[model samples]
Target chain A: MSLGEFELIGRYFRSMELGNAGGSEHVTLGIGDDAALISMAPDKQLVVSTDTVVLGTHFPPDYIPANLAYRALAAAVSDLAAMGARPLSFTLALTLPEVDETWLQSFAQGLTDAARDHRISLIGGDTTRGPLNINVTVLGEVRPRNVVRRGDAQPGDLLCVGGPLGDGGGGLAVVLGESMPSSVSDAARDYLFQRFWRPLAQCELGLELAGVASAGLDVSDGLIADARHLAEASGVALHIRLADLPCSAALQAWPEAQRMEWMLGGGDDYVLLFTLPVASIRCLEVWASQGFDVTVIGEAVVGSGIWLDDGQELKEKVQPAGYQHFQRKSND
Target chain B: MSLGEFELIGRYFRSMELGNAGGSEHVTLGIGDDAALISMAPDKQLVVSTDTVVLGTHFPPDYIPANLAYRALAAAVSDLAAMGARPLSFTLALTLPEVDETWLQSFAQGLTDAARDHRISLIGGDTTRGPLNINVTVLGEVRPRNVVRRGDAQPGDLLCVGGPLGDGGGGLAVVLGESMPSSVSDAARDYLFQRFWRPLAQCELGLELAGVASAGLDVSDGLIADARHLAEASGVALHIRLADLPCSAALQAWPEAQRMEWMLGGGDDYVLLFTLPVASIRCLEVWASQGFDVTVIGEAVVGSGIWLDDGQELKEKVQPAGYQHFQRKSND
Candidate 1:
């Protein structure tokens, strides 16, 4: 049966209990009128980020709808985490070639699960008929002084990552049917696939490191590539110790060179990469003790560009070989 | 030369003087970061809305880039206007099939013009490779008590419109090469085309009507259809006088039947439709004197659905025949 826009929304999205709909302190209005009304704490500032994921480009055309929805939201919310902002609400502007009720149902379920995981409400959205694309604009709040910026890292600051790298890339390979060696177990494959489909946003870690991290951003692009952004923004050089880069067991199962490539150049990790003063190392340890998985991978120095130290020698410069959208091969 | 996503954004969108960059009280941080930071007055509530306009569906494939961008932003910002909120900032998530530098430049120029006209900043955005789609999320601020809701119109409230109707539909017809009668002058055609390309959002009027309007919304989806939404929300019947609809002279140049159809069933007008207490007629007149063209169309009554009064007889029922995304014929 063909569903009109309102009926489709009413049947799947509007009826779902995604939180903060009827009686929310901050969300005065949600998902019914022309706009959504929200109120933040007196001392808080609003933070917003938008991300778009397209079929065939961001994911395989046949990818599961639920997982695609979850990943789309996770990627958008990761920006909020990068800003050290508390997730409040998000609006999804979804375009579909056709309305498949079953696909929409699964997508909505996944979106609801993601919303619950991120502790954010679905405030308002627009659905249109077009190529399959999901654009999520996430709203968050943070105390002005506590917010982290990408351009504040000073020389002699320690560079850190919130989680392991390369799992996302490895998972993508697995999803694309890359043949694994006999050493790769089912558990490892499952772990990597989970990482690809449900890369967690480091919200709690970001909030905790608000005053500690001098410069920060989420690693949507590859670690080495995204690190250059921080370095350029802060006008400092990042010296990354190649051996110190964190890797999940699933990623480590691959060849050392492949794992290293993924570690340095895999995109969609959604891990927070940040810079903190040497004096804040103690705070990092404290955060680690409190269940925040942070790994010190490098240092910021008074220079330019990214330098790779492989324990023996320091590589002069590194290229940002992350996934560039328009530069990629056409899906056609 | 093919442009990477970052390079394309930096070359066109980022460098544009769309407003509220470098130094703005509300926009603490604009583009180039993970998210945008905005702070509003303590007494104001935040209003937000998202809209997605897709190529081949919302606009023709060969539509001018600048006009398309302007119209997209205007449509999204119109939601803020409908909520009686002051425009602040917006984020754009644009998906394109390919990177065309010339098209990008033109689109950016149009977007810049729209942002300047609306007095809103392009704080953040995302660019991805996909079918052409523009999703804009707009944020605004309004005093809590002054906000107009769709569910608050009393039975005796007078229904009013902020501006002329049917011009948008008439303009769309012009754009689609609809042959007008010989009597339709060139000036009228030019006016209609302009109306289609640059439908102004009644933001100032919405803000002015905040306390005066009991209930309100923008007329995006035809008059009778959208009026039904207001009626349903208010739990009252809207009795609209067909002859009382404010139509532009350009639209009036069409045949009477065609003009009536366009007036009753045209979409994308982006004008404000509201209900006010009879005691506020003086306020309406005062607003009219100040260049806010508001016309009283009918009244709300204790019933359900929409009742049309054509001066001769009252039509008991009317079907909503607005533009619906998925239900329409496939572009394929």
Candidate 2:
């Protein structure tokens, strides 16, 4: 017999723990009894964030359900990454048009694997009939060390990105008819595809950079728009050294125009865009031995508006400034 | 000329703050920020919970969109009520099919009203196109004081519900074609309909009964199902008194069979269902004089299963229970 939703969660979704809580902090609890108990911490503060991914909006139609599930968790985890909050747990609200057993098995397996990897529990959520949608709420804790905000960037702070800019957008291009991954070579294409589908939440980087990173946000809405947001919020001008933006081997192999488009306008890369004090650039190098390094792209200056240093008066109309639904479909 | 989603949120959704964070020594920063910063007393901990409501699944299809928004937030707030936690703040993930200008205005108005009424801030969330679904993650504070669990009920404890039962379900009867609201006329019918749509989260009662109530939960599913859950978790049996089950004036006037169905099977009444120490009932009565009242409907015993005092047997004819959406529709 096929297991019920409750039974499915009971067997696979329980027992995972995230945050220092590890299911012990008393702040949050997962499925088991009638209700979960949470014991608030004394010195630490709590940060809560939520995100939802509809089937065709956040992901491609051809995207596998398991991959979609992992990406859903990652999307919310990305919020924690932005807040420098150690995730305690997450509740998933999954709505599906149908309960295909095989699809559910794959989806639950992916959800369980991702939760275990992040140590976040599937506390409690609901399932219902609807078009495919997954809403995830992540509970996290922050220390006084820092809960980074987008408004904290100073005029002279160095603007940087934790990782690459637009592989997801490029991978999406490959998913649609506009581009071919084979153009970037098989292995590199595979790398970009996976990165686009199951982007990692840079939790460790967020925690480590909390004190040093002055202003930060997760790069869900293409780099240009998100960076514009950072600058607008911080009341500063952001200049991008098109040469300084990170890229994947696949993107490097693309034509200069195409590669730059992905970096500037692609969404769902799940990387961190942050700024740090100009003096901290030296500290960044000292921490480079930890296998993490960010290239300083520019500095925050007094003013607003983004500058593209590619020596072009225009570049594909700035990809219409992030993917807004009902505005238009993406052609990247 | 109407504001876009981002503009609407920026202009109106900002400046939302829960009482002053500076007034409390534990709160570091209140609202108008990415996340509210809070410090817990060395002895106190935080409780986090989430709840979701869909347009058609949790509420009637024809209910006003604004009322649905209000009720969705309340459903989630009720989780704090069950945990005996003080409401801090909540984040909302609202999914809608199309951006109806009038609908968005009404929905936001309802959301703001509910947040203001509850003294909780709308921290941050996402907006997207899909079936209408509202998911809220509520964060509250609690002491080590036995953070009530469904498993903690003792044999001699009194099964108490914070308020009357069945009004919500009876209201649903009026909503669906099942029955009419003959009991409560006109505006009162609208009131019952609103209550069924968005019942008040019993945060006050939860806080008052914290140390005294051994086990507690919010009754989203009917009394029988939720009671069965409490009994199973507490490792005891429950004998519910039909005579003692608190009935509202609206429900009391309904036909006996209809009321029974509504009270025992209808869900979405966010009242606190808990078992209190018999001795604490007196203290509870004292608080009742102040505002909140506790009604004893049954007793927990050293056995398993649920029994109704009506002297009739409950036979399980159907395998499935509340809020089911498992099977795929043939139409789909």
Candidate 3:
């Protein structure tokens, strides 16, 4: 059955009682009012970020609602994670052509699960009738001194990734009708699909790297384009080794040349790319023990842009074109 | 020239430096980063609200970009005003089919004007290529005890409005090609057009009524529908007098029956409708001297639901329908 705006919000969005995870203290009031009220602790600074995902542009037209919700929320939360912020709460503004009860239920469930995982509440939002679009604004908290920024990367700092990448790109390719490698196992294929559907924002790793990392940001619009951003922001050159690029077993099963394209230029891999001093990396060994696969991939140098390498030979400079919204095509 | 997402944001949105006011104390970081950082004082609670306006649905397809931005921001900020919250910061997510430089300039100017008026900074946001849509998320602050809510109206409380209503409705009629009333003065027509183009949020008045008002909400979806919401939330009946509905001379230029319909059920007024004890309203007399036309219009009763009156005769119950987004039709 189709639901009206009020009933849809009440039946699906409002029932995600996130207060159970000790998060209600942050929310003085939630949905069903003009606005939601929240409180920030004296010692914490609030981090705010917003992201928009439009159907047919951001994903395929027939995408599942649940996965769309999860991916959109994850993408927004990734910005907060880059700032070393812990999730506090989020608001979603959704524009839909029509209300499908089953779709709403699935989307709400995915949003609920994601919010619960990050210990944040869906405090307030608005739903309107239009073409399908989701805009999420996430509020997070970080200690003032521990906030990480992209402009603080130092020359000689080692570049590291919080985890593997390119699985999401591979899955996207498959979803767009590109056949998966026959050699890829069923479990690996499933892993890639899950990675595409539910990208894990590196919040925990970011929090751990708070005061430790020199600079950081989540990989969204391809590694090469994002690396150029970091280099420009930090006033340094980032040199990456293609051999050191991290990938999953599923990605490795793909054609060798195609794997490089996905790993270097593909978008939507929400893993954290950060910089740390060589000595500091050794001191931050606890993350590995905690099951985080922090891998050193490159280093920052005293220069301007981004340079690529294939272990033996220094490759050509990578283009800075990323997944820009208005640009017709950007390496994605 | 058409602009890319980054160029558009950099040229138009980033230059609004709201930190010039006393507000910068709450913002540890502003735009141009992964996330914007904000801090709230220990004594204040944060209030958050979000709203979305899409082309052709919220406004006409050929709406001017500047007025669209202004009205959209005003509508969103009205929610914060309803909660008696002071503006802190805001995030905007805009989706556009194409980037028109002239449109962006006008929209940015309107956004800057509004942000300057409210002294709130544009913290962080996203821009995407899609059908034209604008989503704004506002953050504001209020003292813990002084927070105004919807369910706190007492049986003996007096209902009041911050200012006149229905001018926006009249203006909207003109915008939709309903010929202006033949008797309407040129000045009155201009006033109505201005009201529709730039609805004001009664933030100052709401802040003044912080601890004084028992319950409150901004009149967006007309007085009838919104008052019903208040009554349902407070578990008390609200009796509104038709003759007492504060309206502008511009609205009076329309037909008597049309004016009443617009006053009772028209949307986009963005004025505060609040309830307070009879005695507490007297303490608010100073606001009138300060140029706020605070007028008493109704009272809360012991029972539930809403009742309508025309001074001596009881009028038919006003239908509790307004400009609901997903509903097929309302007054708008």
List RMSD in Å for every model shown. Answer: 3.3, 4.3, 3.3
What are the runs in model 1 whose C-alpha is more than 4 Å off?
Answer: A1-5, A17-24, A310-332, B1-5, B17-24, B310-332
For residue A332, model 2's alpha carbon misses the true position, in angstroms, by: 18
Candidate 2 local lDDT, B1-332, one digit each (tens): 11245555444445444332211344555433444455666676666666666555334566676677787777777877787877766767777776677777677777777775665666666666667767777766677675777889999998988887777777776676565645556665666776776678887888887887999998877777678778888898888898787777766666676676667766667788999887786876687788876788889987787777864434334422432211211110
**Candidate 3 chain B, run of 10 with poorest lDDT:** B323-332
Model 2 CA lDDT for position B245: 76
How far residue A103's Cα lies from its native spot in candidate 1, in Å, is 0.4
Question: Per-residue CA lDDT of candidate 1, range A116-168, in tens?
Answer: 78888888888877788888999999999989999999999999999999887
Supply the global lDDT for candidate 3: 0.79
Q: Report the poorest 10 consecutive residues by lDDT, candidate 1 chain B.
A: B323-332
True contacts kept of each: 0.72, 0.40, 0.68
Evaluate all candidate structures by whole-model CA lDDT and list the values in order.
Answer: 0.81, 0.69, 0.79
User: Model 2, chain B: what is the TM-score?
Assistant: 0.85
What CAPRI-style quality would you assign to candidate 3? medium
List runs of model 3 lying over 4 Å from the truth.
Answer: A1-4, A19-22, A310-332, B1-5, B18-22, B310-332
Q: Which candidate leads the pack in DockQ?
A: 1
Task: Note the B-chain TM-score for every model.
Answer: 0.92, 0.85, 0.91
Candidate 1 residue pairs in clash (backbone atoms < 3 Å): none
